[model samples]
Target: MEYKWVVLTNTTLGVIMSSMNMYIVLISLPAIFRGLGINPFLPGEFVYLLWVLMGYSIVMATVLVTFGRISDMYGRARVYTWGFVVFTIASIFLSLIPSNSGNAGALLMILLRIVQAIGGGLLMVNSTALLTDAFPPSERGKALGLNQASFIVGSFLGLILGGMLVGYDWHMVFIVNVPFAVAGALWSVLKLRRTPGTGVVRLDLAGNVTLAAGLLAISLGLTYALMPYGNSQMGWTNPWVIASFPLGALMFVLFVLSERRAPAPLFNLSLFRVRPFSYGSIALFLNSLGRGAIMFLVVIWLQGIWLPLHGYPWESTPFWAGVYMIPMLVGTVIMAPVGGMLTDRYGARLFATLGMVIMALSLLALTILPYDFNLFEFELILFVSGLGGGLFSAPNTTAIMNSLRPQDRAAGNGMRQTFSSMGSTISMALFFSMLVTFFTMYVPNEISSAVASYGLPAQVASFLSSIPASGLLFAAFLGVDPASAIPQSVLSALPHSVVELLDSRTFLPSIIGPPFMDALRISLYISVALVLVGALFSWMRGGKFVYEESAGRPGEGRS
Candidate 1:
């Protein structure tokens, strides 16, 4: 077999493993909490839940650029192999975590996940550079397409795979990654060559510190901003959350200044001068921002609303939600390679712009559906969105990679991944804030009225109405019954029929659906607008331009 094929296969495997880990724990969180003997909904425990969900991504975002620069200074293949080793070891520890260890177990899980994220960051920052190194310019689009397709497919598959594995035991979810990681590590070590670096060994200490600090602050703020503040549905007003953004921005400004002065900068800000690289990155950020939260929204839609309203039990909703999203996987699988191959022939600009346009239209289509939307309609819209993602991802990534000089590939790819990751983090915070805002406006009255009509006492109704929107959404997200949060004494005092109704799967969904959909429509509209702007930026990336050392600056002469 050819060396390029080996690179492709190994890199794809690494990406799949890394991407799957991101979502596997997400879907299996309920089971994980159960195994830990902790309630995620309890007052102090919510922080643990937030950390578990956001920690990996935050760590990945913070370190990607640093890892990328390190790969360039050392050797891409060597650093990448080390990533597999670290990830494999972390998976082993995660799987063996003692059950019923309570908060200690949850903290241990979070710490291990942070370690896993470090490995994932290494793989992500260098994989594209390695692929770009191995493949010819003409074939890079197809190579990257297949690699990126695995990433998206793996994330979706993780949802289903987690649901399946967690049914028997939550430990199985982490255990499943060990064999793959071990094989990948061994394969990487034996087959991959360590390409020589730029020979400039000095590290950019200032740049690294500033950039990492900035991203860390920003990520933490976004994560915590999803929590409720005093008398508010979200924590946007919290002094810590409020301070984090400007401080992060100030740190970023300092990072830029430090980079300009550094002997060896972590990020090559000059690369932004390349039109395709710059425009493609902006488009990528916008597209990611628009689509990142769709999975969470759709999952909540299925698990919290549609499935329950249609009589599926709450415990089964998480698994079935993954099953229903199969059409999206199919769409991505079919379109990603085709889009990449076609971009190689016709140039990335056309395909990428068209993809974002399709994305905007599909997102717009979703807004027209009622809360009790037709299943076929929902699936069809999701499939279309997936197709748009497939079409855009490979070509856009190919364009950005192709426009960079060989020496700059790792750092450039790292910078690109940073944008994508940060966009996703911010998107989750932004969309969730929007949802919670709408929930605050509508849910309290809806809950109070529903319970009142059920003949609950005024105090009971008041207490139910006062339940925080974030808690309710988290309950819905975890596929736990909302009534589980009620005090046992209160539940026992309620009439038998009312108690039955309160505990039933349909009750929360019935009242929550309308408010959720109202928020969802507004979010969809915002997504449409974001994607449309992304399409415009994609169009601005101009014609196909591949960098060559002799070709002068990137946009001067097309390869």
Candidate 2:
């Protein structure tokens, strides 16, 4: 194989490994908690869950720009090779953690995941830049398309693989990454050569600190807002959340100022001035924002409500949920490479715009579906949504890379990932808030009615009604039996028949389903609007444009 092929294969494998690790952890969370003997709903324990879920992405998003810049100043290949080593080490550590270790084990896993994120960030920053370096503008789209497709496919496989492996042992979820990482790392060391750094090597301390701190504060605040504060459904009013917003905003303001004055700026302002780069980035951000939450929401709906109602056991729903989501993966796999090929032949604007339109239409279709939707209809809509994502991701990425100078590609890709990572973070926060707000509003009535119908005491009914919707959501999301969420005292007081009725698989869904669907409808509507806006941005990015570097400026003579 050619050297470029070597790079592509190794980097693609890296994408597969890293992305697979991420989604496997996501789907395997219930198993992990079970193995650790941790109660996700316990006070302060939710924080651990949040950390496990979001910490890696948070760290990756926070440090990627700096790492990308460092790779530019040092050598992309060198940094990338080390990334594999670090990621593999982290995976091994995670897999080795003892089940009996309790909170210490959970904390260790989070810390190890942070280390893995650092590695993954390095891989992500350089992988596309390396491909851009290897391929010409005419073929860049296809190469990146294939790369993007691999990422999507990897994520999908993780869902299935998590189901399979976690059924045997939760540790297998992390353990699966080792062999692949080792193979990739060895290939990287043997086959990859260092590409020399461009210009002067300088690190911007002020810019780095401010950016990391700002993003961390903001992400933490958003994540914690899923918890209750006082009598409120969400902790948005909590002092910490309140204080984080202004503090994060102030830090970001300082970061911008520092970037403007720094001898070697962290982010290049001139890159944003380029029409395609700026608009393409914005479109990508919007697409990620619109699409991120919907993926998890679908999983939750399948695992928590739909599958259970259809006779799947609560503990078995995680695996089946992934199984049901296969259509989305299939659609992406089919479209991504084709979209890339088309973008290379034509321009990205039309294809990318059309993809977003399709996605919006799919969201609209989903909005009208009942909580227990027709399986075929649900799968069809999922396929369309996946197709749209596949169509947009690669071409948008290629366009962004094509519009940057060789030296700037690392930093440029970093900028792209930052937008994406931030989008995912914001999407989760937004989706959770939306779900909690509407569920809290309508679920009390639903619960009260159900309890009263079951002839439970008013005190028992009141207590159940007053329990925060967020807790119920977490319980469902974590695949806990709904009856398990009830206080033991309440369960003991209830008649045996009432207990059985309340504990039935369909009972929780009946209580929460209507409100969940109500919230989901609004969320889908918002997603439609967001993706349409994204399409508008994509259309405005103009024709296929490639940058050529000269005298430290890019795209100067290309047009």
Compared with the true structure, what per-residue lDDT tens digits does model 2 show for residues 17-61?
Answer: 988887888778877877887754453455566678667767766
Q: What TM-score does candidate 1 reach?
A: 0.94
lDDT of 2 at 463: 59
lDDT of each: 0.82, 0.81
Residue ranges of candidate 1 with Cα displaced over 4 Å: 37-47, 198-200, 226-237, 552-559
Return the clash pairs for model 1, or none. Answer: none
Tens digits of per-residue lDDT for model 1 on 295-411? 768777887788888888766665787788778777877789989998888889999999899889888998889878899998998899889888988999999998998877888
The best candidate in terms of TM-score: 2
